[model samples]
Target chain A: MDKKIAMVDDDTDLLNIYKPVLEKAGYIIKTAFDSSEGLKLYKEFKPDVIFVDLSMEHFDSGFVLCHRIKSLPEAKKSKVIIMTSAGHETGIRFSTDTEEEKNWIKADDYLEKPISPRDLVQYLNEKIFKEK
Target chain B: MKIENGKILVVDDEKGMREGIRRILEIQGHKVDTTDSGALGIQKGIATEYDIYFIDLKMPDIEGTQVLREIKLMYPEAICVIVTAYASIDTAVETTRMGAYQYIPKPFEPDELQILVHRALERRWYILEARRLREEQAKHLLEVAHEQSRMRTIINALDDGILIINQEGQAVLFNPGFLKLLDINQEISIGEPVLEILPTALRDQIKEIFSGKGSVNAIKQEITIHPPAKLVVMANTTPVMGKKGELLGVVSVLRDISELKKIDIIRSQFVDMAAHELKSPLTAVQGYLELVVDKTLGDEPDLYDSYLKRSLDRTKSLVNLINDLLNITRLEAGKVRRELNRQNIKELIIDRLNFFKNDISERALKVNVDIDSNLCVDADRDDLLRLFTQIIANAVRYNKPNGQVNITGRQNTHYVKIDFQDTGLGIKKEEQDRLFEDFFRAKNEFTRNITGTGLGLTIAKKIVDAYAGKIKVESEYQKGSTFSVYLPFAKQNNFTIKNSP
Candidate 1:
């Protein structure tokens, strides 16, 4: 099952690393370096999942980019993902996935940076494939 | 001043008996008077109010008992002893009821009469002195009592708890604060040992240590008590001293430093977040850049060379920024481990000088190093290195190209001093006071295009404080600045400097 994925990061190198990996796994990848460009690209591509880096050129850019994409009528149900570094994701608070709030820009996945290619494929399979 | 014994009066038909009694009493320092006849004795008694009446028992004119009854009626306290014979001695029992010293029968021994007279005089003197002293002592006691009550009033009014203990460590006097702070209530009493007033550990610590050589030395310790384990507190203890330099007891103020602990938690969080923010990106940049230059550039030479050069340049910039951020965060966290080893004064300056070689050569700058090589100081190596980085980097950053930065070190047995003098744009005197504060940039930020985030001296000061050393800056607006650091010398072999690359 091929899926379309859009990723946004202010760090060009991190975007370059994940874009190639996602593309080879049969997921169509779209990239943006900052918030305004990422939102425009998100509406046009309307990808199955969105991965936003927490810090862009400005801090908290990922939250801004994710919120803008989810507010749109066409992308409300899209599975939004937050990509982070290992130091970023160890222990953060989250609600259970079954809640109705999951419909809008659901950050159902987290991928730690220097992320291995195998773990990423399995994660995408579990969130996008297993849901079916 | 003289009150006669008031018991002896001489009255005799025979003048010689009268003279003998008068001569003995007068010799014994008594005031005496005599008469020749009972009529004359009665006349003297009536005229001058004599204390005793002595007449012949068988008087030719009048009976002695009759005269005695008249004398008793006239002055009841007066003693009237009738000088009589042995045959008439049975009647002397009546004289006892009549208040006589005793009957002196005719032909009495002169010694017996003299002893009687002496006993009577001393009794009068003793009674008078006893009565006088009692009144005097009562007045003195009242005055002393008033002063003690005033003293207790003053001690009670003091906010600091006051306690006076005897050599036995028994709390002889403790103010209201002691009992109130300890929650002992009004049930506390005098003579209770201090241990009974406080928690068990505090009592033992104070009693054991405070009584020894530590009496003058400060007893600063933190104690924790748990009541079923829900709360925690930090207590700071300071010793209280008396005017004579005596150790009264310890005054411990237990404030709950829980908020300070929470701030520590928040600080560690900031360090973690900031470190993660800086390091994760740098790691990716380093790792991936190494991968690209290794794998992607396989002898195509020209194309690979272009990519390698660009990546290394950016990687180095990221590394420097990471280093700067690391230095700031670590110093702020107080994580730099410091040792108090004797550091070679010249080697420290030389090593520090060598580190700036690449940086200084790029700008063609010069630094004068004037410290002797033999001088060494006790200091922390890594901490001193970070200090050097901040000071030297600041010295270069704030200076013009080819500016002279002088680094000097001098050492005595007790202390070692180092100075980094730079001929650069000096700080304004107005900003000199706040030069060591964090995140404060000079007002002339625009005039001097020194690229700094302003955490250099702030971190440097903290490091110096860790060693109990001092750093001071002397600067005038246009006259360039000199920053001096003084570090106390610790014993040799205190610091073991490892192999340096």
Candidate 2:
């Protein structure tokens, strides 16, 4: 069965980029620019995979949204991933700055920026198919 | 055998008796000087610094009492024994009151004289010791006064407000800054309970800290007071520890972080302005691309096709950039609005995951979901779902070839948790710290070659905060990473899907 994935990010262009690549690879993609729209689709579509962005509206916007979904009773069975461009060196979750800005993580999983098409699908196959 | 180095002072208006006493003492290794008048006797006593003095009870010019007073004033420890003949015992006893060391009645033996001199010397030694102790006490009092002032001055000059409390939680020392911070004054004292001095809200925080449940910095709270007027202060309470690491008390510094606060507002404004400016053109470009891609003109569309495609790519990039910028700005601002509601956890994950199925298929990455589907959380649903979308996007965007990503969720009493596991190229342990920073990419140039605005995850974290949720990640380089999100649970025993605007 083709793996269906949902991509929730405020950036439409980034979401669309995956569309062409994943569609060519034989998978379906549903995209939303904000968590509100994403949640609606999350309930209705129940896609097999999801991609979340952290800096949606702020440093940890993705974290806030992912947390909401994770807390829901019915959504407990869903998987969410975090996306951030800054590498580990920029002190992603462990910045020495004030506690408020130091950490910005809260999702099912996270990845560095600039994801390649081959790498993206390979990872999904490993986590979803291999684990199951 | 006259007394060596002795010039005896014999003062008596009765000249014959003075001579008799002087002669008697001179015969026993002594040199004697006799004065008939009381005034001259005192003058002699003063001029000669004698070891011993013999004064008659009755003296005319300078009464015996007057002579004794002058002599005692000159030499406080001088030995002056009053000598009285028969029937003048009362006068001799009275003379002892006038600074005489002792009284000697007439018809006394030489042994009596010897004993009296020995007692007088012993008394003088006692006087010296007493004087020494008094001097020492004076110095100690002065030193204590000096030390007390120094301590008070330093306490006043310190940057933070300092209130010294005893074991009873009573304020022993409260500086001006401390008083001003707590809005207390003259009424506070050593035995007064700290609660009485501090505002009600602050007192509650102090109680929490004392119980060791919360940290001072972690609970840094802002309090606004309108007593003297309106003022905003961020109060941080730190427990002061003694040399033995005992909890001495607490010291709180209310530093004004207002400057940074204002700067954050300005930065957020910049982000909004930038998003608006970029989105306006991006929307136009997107519309134009849609129209052209639909072959609206029905002519040779090769040029239009490529132009539209390129425009679409550019617009997508612009959109990512704007979103990233906005995310960074919001998280830095520190305050996230909360619109609470219950959300379906499973639905949110699957929905977010669906966005990238095509990409996952093309890249051949596996996906897994292992979660107890009966979980729900109370939070802003919009922010929650977006949080999942961003993280999942990150996993796909940065996976190694032939890797897998697992998405799992579990429900507990108060929270719902989501876990995104990836078998892709995991983040390096050293580089994990900055993973959430805006626009920070990996050091590898090849990784940088991928198309990303480098703002995805940063925005995701901010969105999580808006929902009052927590996010965490675990990754091992070349192994994979797991990102987890936790949100408040639903109380109505059901999941409702909602989102923030």
Candidate 3:
């Protein structure tokens, strides 16, 4: 069975670019332009994996959505990934050493953007879907 | 003889001696008083400040030496002369030792008597004049000391730092204010070379002023103090010229302007960040389009479609950002029209809410409205509508799912207030003061994903200010936020809005 993945971002064009790239990697993908739409799609699709931009519809809205997904009993086994452009999106640096950082973002891994399609697929296969 | 010139007293047991002495002194231009007994002479001397006294050694009651002692003790400046008919060596030595000026025999010549009287009075005049001159000099010195103290007080009381340098670049005068402005210790004594005390940046300008170089007549410059304490100051240096218009030294005044410099730096930083923010989107758009042109995903419609959609969205966001910037510029420049009409407050808010119905339902957020429908205000309809839309839309967009948005409106005697309160990501206390400033968006983990141009609040504030209204925010980080707006009455009561701009 193909892995079910959902990606949420306000940049619809970026989503369009990411959607086919992820789809061609033998994963079924769903896309949303905002946090509200993303949450609705999450409930309907019950995706096995989630990819969200740190800034979408609102600053850190993706983090809030990720937290909500982790709190759900039905989605307990799902893998969540957070994306950002690092220096491009924000001026602050993040450290994963602190438990507070991991719990708040509720993501299993981070993907810095401007990434090629091949790198995105490889990162998912090795870090997320391989465990399943 | 005038008594004011010199008063003389003569005392002797023999009447001939007394009368002869008195006549000689009187003829020599002195007011002479004769006494037949030494006791009488002492009594007269006690009554006045006599300039000269002549006493006889062989007196019946008091001795001449005794009379001389009484007169000299009372008035030490009086010149005493002894006249004794005995003329013995013992009497002469005894009288001279007892404060007498000289000893003259009773059978003395007229010329000798006259010369003794003349010399005694002259010596008395010299002593009085010397005492008078000494007192005058003491008073003059006191007055000069008082004036110098007053001048020092005036210079030290000044707020601006002042320093007067000598021709050799030595600190001739360093006011207390100058030392404090530079944070230099008081132990740094005056007369030290200015190079040893002042920072190089300020010392250079002062040297330029003294050297009569570019704009040296009066030099004005901004300088930053060297580390350990970084301070900005506006230094004004002017040449202190002498009577011949020669450069004596330089007088420098320093005014602290670090606060203003800090504000200027912040404004410039925002401008740079704004430019970079605009360029970043362009760079991303260009990169994606180049990939499409390069055929990285050859013969694959799905792959190219995604890139093209992303490019289109980037263009759209870029347009939105430009529009936001234009609105702020126009509003700040006061180009927006303020055509006011009587507006039903609740109805306008409802109209704005209708535009956000989709967002509210999609988020499943509850909205509570407690507003008086009859409340009306004199305001421009479009401006009021936009104000409501932006504030309420922010409330919905930043709220958590299942959270609540509460709106309330009330009218008082002078103003009408509307509050949009939300259970959303709140602002930090430190960041709240700068929330309305242009390009100032909260940067944190929770605020990083927010989609905004950071110009919304700035424009909102400008619009509210045009109507002389006020907007304030209160929030607790991660708890919630409440934005309150107060719009004053357009005019007096019992009148409707009817102004056009």
What are the lDDT scores of the predictions, listed in order?
A: 0.64, 0.67, 0.76
True-structure Cα RMSD, model 2: 24.2
What's every prediction's RMSD, in angstroms?
A: 17.1, 24.2, 14.0
Docking class of 1: incorrect
What interface RMSD does each of the candidate structures achieve? 8.4, 12.7, 6.6
Task: Provide the interface RMSD of candidate 3 in angstroms, 1 decimal place.
Answer: 6.6
Q: Residue B447, candidate 2: how far off, in angstroms? A: 24
Can you write out model 1's per-residue Cα lDDT over A2-111, one digit (the tens) per residue? 68888886556556555655676668899876778888888888888888875453235565566677677887557778766524321221221344434443556555
Task: Report the lDDT of model 1 for residue A34.
Answer: 70
Report the lDDT tens digits of candidate 3 across residue range A1-132: 889999886655456555766776788999876677778888899998888776543345777888888878876768788776534322222223457768776688777666655567788888777767
lDDT of 2 by residue, A1-132 (tens): 667788886655556545655675667888877767777787788877678766554445566767667666766566777765532223223112344432333355676555654567677777665777
TM-score of chain A of each: 0.75, 0.77, 0.85
User: Distance (Å) between predicted and true CA of B262, model 2?
Assistant: 11
User: Best candidate per DockQ, number?
Assistant: 1
**Top candidate (lDDT):** 3
For residue B419, model 3's alpha carbon misses the true position, in angstroms, by 3.7
Put down candidate 1 lDDT per residue, B373-452, tens digits, no spaces: 76676677777877888888877767667888998887644467888988777888888888886444563432323434
What is the Cα-based lDDT of residue A127 in candidate 3?
Answer: 75
lDDT of 3 by residue, B246-349 (tens): 88888899988888887767655545555644653665576567557756456867766776876786677678678777776677667677888988888888
